[model samples]
Target: MGETDKHRRIMTALIEALIAFFKNIAGVYVSGNLMLYYEEGNPSACVSPDVFVIRGVGKNERRVYKLWEEVNAPDVVIEITSRSTRLEDLGNKRALYAELGVAEYFIYDPNQEYLKPPLQGYRLAQNDYAPIAPDAQGKFHSAILNLDLQIVNDNLRLFNPHTQKFLLTPLEAQEAVEQAETENARLRAELKKLREEK
Candidate 1:
C-alpha cells in the first residue's frame, strides 16, 4: 500500500531536519526511505526505514544499505507509520531492529490513525527493545540522537534538549532567517534614529 501525501511530507521534513542537524558531525549518515539490505546476497532480508541514522559510517550515497558492508546496522531507525504499515512498523520491524542491535527505534503516526499515542520510542536493552518512557508532557527521549520526540498540534517534532528548541524544517528555517533579518533591520533603523537625536 502506498503512503498518503501527509505521510510522505512528514517523512521528508523530518529526514531533512535530521540531516541538516547532523551535517557538521563526522561519520554520521542520515537517509530517508532507503532500502537497507541486512544481508549481502539475500534480497528478501531488507527493509527501507522512513528515516535512519548511522553513526561511525561514511556519509556517502549508495543504492542500498548493506549491513555487512558497513559492519554496523543503523544506530537509529525511525518509521513514519501509516495505517497500512502500522503493524509492521510496530511489530516485525521492531523485532528486526532489536535483533540488529539498533540502539534506538522510533515510530510516528502523523495522522494518529494507527498508534494510540501517535509517537513511541524504544531503546535496546539487554539485547531486547524496551519502551522508552515519555516525560511529563509525553515527549520521548532518544539516547542515540540526544533529542526529544514530541507531537505538537498533530505534528511530530524533534526537540533539542540542550538548545531547548525544536529543529526546524528547511522551509521553517528559511522563515526564521527572514524573520531575523526583518528584526535586525528594525533595530538598525531605531539605532539610526537615536544617533540622529544625539
Candidate 2:
C-alpha cells in the first residue's frame, strides 16, 4: 500500500512528536516506519510499524530492529493505516504483533476515511490482544506509554495525562514558545505604558 504525502507527513510528525517527548527519558526508543526483523537470518520476514516505542531499550539509532538482538519486541506498536493497507494493518500486522508479544497495538487512521473510529487500541492479555476502550473524549489510553491517543480535527494527537497537555511536534512546540514570547512582550509594553501614566 503506497502512502500519499499527507500520510507520510502525518506519520513523520507523530513520530517526531513522540521522540521529542521522550528524548530525555533513559532506556526509551521511539521510531517510525522502521523494519522490525523478527526472525533471525530471514531478512524477508520483517514488519515496519508506523510508530513504535520500545521501553528499556537504549535510545540508539538503528537501520533495522532485529528483535533477537534487542531481546524483546517493542512495548508499543502503532500503525498509521491508509486505504491501501487497511486490511493488512488490521489483520496480518495485528496477528504478527500479538504473536511476537508486543504488549500494545494501536491503529490510527490519519485520513479518517477507513477506520470506523479513526483510533483503536489493544492490550496483550494472556496470549491475545484485548481491546482497550476509549474514554468519553474518544481517546484511547496506552498503559505502556501512559498517554492518551486522540484525534483532534482529523489529526492524531497524543495527550500527556500527567501534564494535562497534548504532546506537540517540534514545529508546534516552537510556535508555542514564539506565541508565549510575543504575548509576554505585549504585556510588558502595556505595563510600561501604565507606569508612565502613573
Candidate 3:
C-alpha cells in the first residue's frame, strides 16, 4: 500500500478500537470521521469529527452520518491532532460542533508535540465551549456520556463512572461478563451451604 493508504488504515484501526472500548461499557453510538453535510459541493461546509459519541443511537456501523437523517449531532466529538489539520480541528471545527449543539468537544494530541499536555475538553454552555478541568488523574469527565477520558500509555481511554472501571473493548467486555457470572455462581453455592446449615 502507499504511504497515505497505510496511514489511513492505521488511524482507522485505532479509531475502531476506541469505539469498541466505549460501546462495551455504555449504550452509545461511536463514529469516526464521518462526513457531516451542511451544504452540497461546498468544501468549506464539510465537517468530519475524528471520533464522536452519540448516546442512545443506533449501534450499527454507518458509512456516513447525515445530520438530516440522524436528526441530532453527536453528543461528544473528539479530534486527534494531525500536522495538516491541527488548526482546523482547534478553530473552525470547534466552532462547527458548538454551532451544531454538540454537548462536549475533546481534542487529543497523539504525538504530544503541538498541544502540550495532549488533551483538552469542553462542555457546551450558552452555544459555546466552556473549558472543563481534568481530575487529579488528569482525566476529563464527559457530561454527555457520563464517562471520563484519560490518556493511558499514549492512547486515549474511556472510564465508565457507573462501573468505576475503565471501559473495555468488545472482547474485554465479554471476558468481564463471563468472570461476573462465575463469581455469582460461587456466591450462590456459598449461600446455599449456609442455608442448609441453618
Candidate whose TM-score is highest? 1
Model 3, span 4-30: residue lDDT tens: 453354346446655766646655787
TM-score of each: 0.89, 0.89, 0.72
- Candidate 3 is scored at a TM of 0.72
Predictions in order: lDDT: 0.89, 0.89, 0.76
lDDT of 2: 0.89
For model 2, how does the per-residue alpha-carbon lDDT over 35-118 read when each residue is reduced to its tens digit?
A: 899999999999999889998889989999998899878899888898889999999999999999999999988878899888
Which should have the higher TM-score, number 1 or number 2? 1
lDDT per residue, candidate 1, 1-198, as tens digits? 577887887888888899889989999999978889887779999989889999999889888888898897899998988878888988899999999999999999888877988898889999888889999999999988988999988878899999999999778989999999999999999999999999
Lowest-lDDT window of 10 residues in candidate 2? 1-10
lDDT for residue 138 in candidate 1, whole number 0-100? 92
Clashing pairs in 3: none
What are the runs in model 1 whose C-alpha is more than 4 Å off?
A: 181-198
